[model samples]
Target chain A: MADPAGAPCVEVVDLHKRFGALEVLRGVSFAVDRGSVVSIIGASGSGKSTLLRCINYLEQPTSGEVRIDGEPIGIERRADGSERRRSMREIGRFRRDLGMVFQQFNLWPHLTVLGNVVEAPIRVRGLPRRQAMELARACLERVQLSEKSSEYPARLSGGQQQRVAIARALAMQPKVMLFDEATSSLDPELTGEVLEVMRGLAVDGTTMIVVTHEMGFAREVSDRVIFLHGGLIEEEGPPAQVFGTPRSERCRQFLAKLLH
Target chain B: MGNWERLVWNQRNVLLDGFLVTLEICAIAFAVAVAAGLGLALLRLYVRPLRWPAIMWIEYCRATPIYVQLMWVNYVWPEILGWPTTFYTAGWVALALQSSGYLAETFRTGIENIGRGQREAAYAVGMSPLLTFRRIILPQVLVTIAPSIVTQFTVIVKSSTLVSVITVQDLMFQSQRLVNVWFEPIEILTATAAIYILFIFAVSAAGKALADRLRLRYGLGT
Candidate 1:
C-alpha cells in the first residue's frame, strides 16, 4: 500500500559520523518514501554502508537525527531539550520494523537453514514454534529454498547461502529492508540468484534501501538513484536522467568507467 | 626378591586412586572454566574497551605457572582472608581459575572470527544481545573453536597433576610417595610418566572423535 504524501518511512537529517579523525558520513541527508526502492551507489569507502547502518542506529551518528515512520530512531529528547541515547533493548525492539542483509550471507553456520529462518521469529518476536516454522517455510518457499531447510549453511553454495539470508530476514515481516552490497561476495553466476530475490522483493513492493555496485540492477529496480562520493551525496535523480545524462563529472566518469 | 616384586606389583591400587582424583579435578575445573570463559568472551564481544583488560587477565594467568597458582591458593588465600579454605577446594579453585584464562582467550578468538555480519543479521531480526549470543553467536562459536577447546581440556587434565603440590593426594602425589618409600625412583617415575602419557592419549582420541561427530551432525564437513 502506498503511504500518504509527506509521510516518509525513513528520514536522515544532516547525519555526521566520525571515526577518530575521519568523518565517514558528512552531513548526509535523505528521505525514503514508503513502498519505494532507493539504491545508493558509490565507490569503496564512499559511506554507503555507513548511511545504511546509520538508518538503523547500528552506528550512532556524531550529530543528526534519523527518523523512521516519524519516530526518532535512537534518541529521546526531554522537556529540557537534553537527549538520552536509546537503550539496546529499545533499539532491538525498533529494529524489528527494519531488516538488513549484509554483503556476506551471514547465516549462523552451526544452525540448519530452517533454524536460521525460524530462530528470530520464534525468539525475538515470541511467536510459537509451530507458527514460526510455518512462517519460515513460507519464506524459504519465496526464496526457492524450501527443500534445503534441514541442511546446514556450510553445505550451501554462496548463492544458496545468500538466498537463505534473504529468507531469514523476510520471515520477520519487516516494514523496511536495508541491503548493504548484498551480492558483492558472490561469483558472477551466483550474483544472479541473489539479485533475482531482491528483484522479487521490489516487485512485491517491499520498502528498501539498497547499497550496491550493480548498475544494471540500480537502473532497473530503483525508483531513485543516489550517487555518494567522499561521504557526501554527489548527485541523485531518476535513473534515466542520472545514468543517461549525468549531472556531475564524477558521476559521468563513474558511469563511463563502470559501464565500460 | 619375591617379596619386592609383590610390593611393586600392587601399584595398580595407586593408579586407580590417582585416576579418580584426577577425574574429579578435571571435571570441576573444566565446568568452571567454560562458564567463566563464556562470560569473559561475551565481554570481549561487545565492549572494545574491555578487550585489552580481558586479554591481560588471561595472559597473566597463563604466564604464571599453574603449580605456583595452586601453591598460592592453598597456602596464601586462607592466610590472607583469615578464613578456612581447604586444600581440596583450593586445588580445584586454582586449576579452574587458571583454565578460565586460557579458555577465555580461545573463546574470544572464536567469537571474533565469526563475521560481524552474523551478529548484524541477528540484530536486524530484533534479537536481544543475550538472545543473539545464546542462539546465534554461541552455537557458531562452539563449531568454530571446538578443536582448540578440546585441546585445552586435555591440557587441563594434565595440569591437574599440579594439584599434588597442595597435598591433594592426586596421581602425581601418590606416585611421589611410592617413589620415596620404595627407593625405586627410576622404575616408579617411568611408570608414572607412562600412565600420564596413556591418559592424555585417550583424552586426545576422545576429543577428536567428539569433534568429528559434531561436524557430521552439523553438516560442517562433507
Candidate 2:
C-alpha cells in the first residue's frame, strides 16, 4: 500500500562519503519520485558515482541515511539511540529491490546470457527454472537481445554486452535502476545503441538514477538533472533549467568545458 | 621354456597386483590432497585464527623432503602419539600431507586470478556471501586449476614409488622383488619405467580432455 504521507520512492538525506582523508561526497541529498528519471552529471572526480553508490548501499556513507519506500536502508535505529548496520543477509535482501548496471557490464562470464539474466531470480528469488527462463527471455527481448540469449558475454559486442547487462538487471524487477556510467566504456560508435535501450526504458516510465557524462541523454531524456562539483551538488532543477541556465559558477564553467 | 617367457609367466600377476596398489595409493592421496589442500587455502585466506598456522604448515611441508616426511610419519609419529601406524597409512598420509601444500598454492593462485568484479557483481545481485562463493567463485577456481591438479596427480602417482622403502608392496617394491628373484635388473627396470610412462601419459590426456570440455562448456576459451 502506498504511504498516504507521499514519501518518494528514493530518499537520500545529507549523504557524506570519505575514503581515508579524501572526502568524496560532502553532504549531498536528493529525492527521486516514482517512475521518474534523474541524471547526475559532473566532471571527473566530482563524486557523482560515489553518490550513486551510496544510494544503492554499494559504498557505505560516512554519515547519512538512505530510504527506499520510506524505510531506512542498511541501518537499524535501535531504542538505545544508536544506529547499527544491518547484517549482510539483511542488506542482500534489501538490495534485491535496487538493480545496478556497472560501466564494465560485469556479467557472470561463466554463464550464458540467459543464465546471467536469470541468476538472481533463480538463486535469490527461488523462482523455478522454467519460470525464470521465461522471465529471462522476456527481459532479453525487451533489450532486443533475444538472439544472443544462449551466447556468452565475451562473444557479444560491447554494446550487446551492456544491453544484456541491462536485461540482467531488469529481470530482478527492481524499484529503481542505478546506472554508473553504463555507456562510458562503450566505443564512441556503439554508445548510441545502449543509449537507445535506455531511452526506451525511460519512455516506458522506468525509475532510474543515472550517473553519466552523456550530456545529450541527460538534456533530452531526464526529467531532472543534478550537476555536481567538488563533492557537492552545484545545480539541480529541470533539465532545461540546470542545463540551459546553470546557476553556480562552478557548474557553469564545468558545463562550458564539457559542452564545447 | 625360454628365459624371458618364464619370467613373464611367473611375474606378470605380481607386477599387476603391485600396479593396482600403486593406483589405489595415488587415488586416495589425490582425494586427500584436494580436500585438505582446498581447506588449507581457504583457511589461510579467510579464517583469521587459523591463518598463520595454515601458512606456517604449508611452508613447512613445501620446505621439507617428502621422503623424510614419510619416514617421520611412519616411524616417529606413532611413537610420539602412542598409536599404530602401518606402511599403507604412512605412504598415503605423508604423500598427501606434502602435496597438499602445492595444491594449496595452486588454489590461491587461481583465486587471485579471478577479478574482484566477479564477487562484486554477485553481491550486487543480492546473493549471500555463501551463495556468491558457491555459485560465482568456486566454479572459476575449479576450472582454473584443473590442469595443475592433473599435473599434481601424475606427480603423486610417481611419488607412490616412495612407499616401497616401507615395504608397501606397491609397483617399485614388487619390481625390486622381481629383480631380486630373477636377477634381470635391466629388462625389468625398463619394463617398469614403461608402465609408469603409460600410466602418467593416460592421466595427462584424460585431464586435458576434461579441462577442454569444461572451458568450452563454460564459454571460457577456444
Candidate 3:
C-alpha cells in the first residue's frame, strides 16, 4: 500500500547512526518508489553503505525510521506513541521483505551454487527441498549461471560468484533489493559482468537501491541519483539534473572527482 | 624367553578389552565435550546475561588438573552430594568436563574467525539469528575447526590414562595389573607405550584423511 505522499516502497526518515563517539549518518533521509532504480553515490566514509544498510536494518539506526511498503521497520510504537527499537525477532520478520547483495559476494564456501541459492528458501521459508531447488535453478538461469549450479563458490571466478550471490537473493523474491557496493570487490573487467545482471534487473522493474561508485552506471541506470556528503544529502534529482546542473558545491566536487 | 612371549600374547585379549572400554569412554566423552563446549561458547558470546557464568565454568574447568578433577568426581563428589557414581561414570564425566573447556576455547576462536560478511549475507536473506547460526555460522565453524578438534581428541585419549587413578580399569589400569601379575614392568609398560603410539598415529592419520576429504568437497585451498 502507498503512503499519503506516494506509493513509496522504501522510505527513510531522519536516519542518524553513530559508531561509538563518531557519527556515521547525520540526519539522512530519502524515499524510493516501487519499480524504480535509485543510486546513492558518495565518497568513501560518507555513509552511503551505512545508509543502504540502515534501510535493510543491517545496521540499526541510532535515531530515525525505515519504512518498507509504508510500514515502519525494526521499530514499534510505544504506549505514549514514540518509536522504540523492535526485538531481533520482530526485525527479522520485517527483513524478509527485502533482499540485499554485498561487496564480497559472501556465498557460503561449502555449499554449491544451487545450494547457496536455495538455502534461505528451505531453511528460512521452509519450502520443500525439490521446490527450493527448482526455484534456485530458475534464479541461476536468470543470472546465466545454470551450468555452474553444481560448482562450489570457491571454484567460481569473482564475477560468476557475484552472479550466484544475486541469484541467491532473487530466489527469495523480495519486494526491495539493497545493493551494498555489490561490485566493489571485483576487478574492473569483472564488475561489468555483475553490472550487466543488475542492468537486466533494472529493465525488468525490480525495486532497487544501489550504493555505488560507478559514475557511468549511476548516470545511465538510475532513475534518480542521490549525492551524499558528510552523512547528508548534498543533492538529489533525476540523473540528468544532478549530473548536469549540480545543485550543491559538495555534489559538484564529488561528481568532478568521480568523473576523472 | 618363551614365557615372556606367552605372557605378552596372552595379555593381548585383556588389552583389547581395555581398549574397547577406552574407546567407548572417548566416544561418549567426545560427544559430551562437543555439546557442552558448543553450549559454553554460545553462552559466552551470545547469551550476554550468562557470560560470567560461562566464563567462570570454562576457567574453573581449565585451571584444575584433570587427574585431580577425576579424584574429586569419583571419591569426593558422591559423598558431598550424597549421590552414587561408579568409577567408570566418574572417569568419562570428568574427562568430558575438563576437555570441554579446551574445546570451548577452540569453538570460540572458530566462531570469531568467521568474517562479519557471512553473518550479514545470512541476515540479508531474512534469516533469523537461530537459522543463521544453524545453517551458516555453525557449519562453517565446525569445518574450520575440525582439525583442531581432532587434535584435541588426541589429547583427550592421552589423558585417558588419568582415568586409571579413579580405578576405572582402562588400558593403563589393565597394563598396570598385567605388569604386577607377570612381574615385568619393562616388558608390559613398554608394550603399553607402543599401544598408545599406535592408537595416536591411527587417529592423527584418520584426522588428516578427513581434512583432505573435506578440503576437496568444500574446494578449500591449502
Candidate 4:
C-alpha cells in the first residue's frame, strides 16, 4: 500500500534498548522509505535483531521512539511532558500495520498453511471469512505455496515453511515488512527458495527492513545498506558505496571476513 | 460362588444406583475442576495483583488430603458459609477443589512449555495477548498436555471415593451399607474393592485412549 508522499514508511529515532545491566541497543536510528528495501548487516549480537524487534515493540526500547506510517507506537508523549507506555490494545493497533518474519519460521504447528495466512486477517482485521480466504490464497500464490495450502507446517521443509511464513505476513498487507534473519536457520540449499520470494517482494516495491547475514542478497537487492557495529550504525549508504569502499575500517574488515 | 451371587448379583440394583451417584459426582467435580483450574492458571500467569492469591489457593488444595478436605467441606463449609446445604453439593465441591489444584499446575506447565517465539509471532500478527493465549497458546497446550489432563481425571475419580465418608451414598457407601446389614464383611468388602478397581481401570483406559487419539491427530508429533 502507498504511504502519503514524502513521509517515510517507518522511522526510528534515537532508539536505545537496555536489558537490565546489558545495553543491547545504544542510540540506534534509521528510517525506511516506502517502496524501498534497507538491509541491516552486522556480526552476531550487534543488536540487529533487537532493533528490528523494537520497531514492532516486541521488545520495548528503554528510551527513544519508533513510528510506523508517521505515528509513534508503544509509548505516548503527553502534553505534561510525561511518557507512558501505551496499553497493549493501543500497541496492537499500530502493530497491525507492520508484518514481521522471524528467523525461526515460527509457524503455528497446529494450523494449516492457509489457516496461518488467514487467521490474523479474519481475527485482527475482522475481514469476513470468505474475503480472508481470498486474500490468503493470493498471498499463498505470491509465495508459490498455493498447492500446499491445506498442509500443516510440520510437513513442509524449512524453505517451504519460511515461504508460508512470508505469505502469512503478506496476507496482512502491512505498510512495512520486517525480516529478522528470515533464512538464517535454513540449510544452504534451501535458502535460495525463501530468498527468491523475498526478492520478488523487493522487486514489487514492498517497503522492507531486513536484518540479515545474507551478504549477496543485501548487496544486490537492497537499495541501501546499513552496517551495525556493537549497538550503533557504523556505516551506511547505497550498497555499492558501502560495500565497495567502506569509510569505516571495521565495516571493510567485516565485509572482507564474510566474503572470504 | 454362592456368596458372590447373593451379595453382589442379588443387590445389583442398589449397587447400580450407587454407581450412578458416583458417576454424577465425578462428572460434576471434573467439569468444575477443568473450568476453575484454567481460570486459576490464567490468573496466576497473567493477573498481576491476584497471582499470589491464586497460587496460595492452588497450594492449599494440593497439600490437603482428600479425606480431610471432604470432611472439612462437608462439616465446616455449611457452618461457616451457610451454603452447600446438602451433602452431595459438599461432595462434588470438595472433590473439585483438590483436582483443580493439580489441574492448574498441569495447565501451567503446558502453557510454559510453549516456545516464546510462538507468542511473539502471534503478537507480530496483531493478536492481543488474550487472543494469542486463546488461539495460539491454548490449542498447542491442550494437545501437549492431553495425557496429563487424562491422568488428572483419573485422579479425580479415585479421590471421589472419599466423599462416601460424608454420607453421599456413592458406590462405596452403598457397598459398605450392604456389609453392615449382613455383617458378612468378607464377600461384600472384597466385591466392593473389586468393583472400585474395575471402575477406575475402565475410566483410565478410556481416558488414555482418547488422549492418545487426540495426540496423534493434532500433536506436533510427525
Top candidate, metric lDDT? 4
Query: On a 0 to 1 TM-score scale, where does candidate 3 land against the true structure?
Result: 0.95
In CAPRI terms, where does candidate 1 land? medium
Off by over 4 Å in 4: A1-5, A77-84
TM-score of each: 0.88, 0.94, 0.95, 0.95
| Candidate ordering by TM-score (highest first) | 3, 4, 2, 1
User: What TM-score results for chain B in every one of the models?
Assistant: 0.87, 0.94, 0.94, 0.94
| Each prediction's fraction of true contacts recovered | 0.77, 0.62, 0.77, 0.75
lDDT of 4 at A42: 93
Candidate 3 residue-wise lDDT, A19-41, digit = tens: 99989899988889999999999
Residues B48-99 of candidate 2 have per-residue lDDT tens digits of 9999999999998888898998898899989998543688988998889888
Residue A74 CA displacement from its true place in model 4, Å:
2.5
DockQ of 3: 0.74
Interface RMSD of 4: 1.3
* Local accuracy of candidate 4 as per-residue lDDT tens digits, A1-260: 54565568899999999999999899988888889999999999999999999999999899988987776897788999888889988999888888999999999988999999999999999999999999999999999999999988877999999999999999999988999999999999999999999999999999999999999999999999999998999999999999999999999999999989
Best by DockQ: 3
Score residue A196 of candidate 1 by CA lDDT: 95
lDDT of 2 by residue, A1-260 (tens): 36577899899899999999999999998999999999999999999989988887778899989998887887988899898889888888878888889998988888889999999999999999999999999999999999998887868999999999999889988888999999999999999999999999999999999999999999999999999988988899999998788778888888899867
lDDT of 1 by residue, B110-160 (tens): 887777777788888888888888888788788767877778888888888
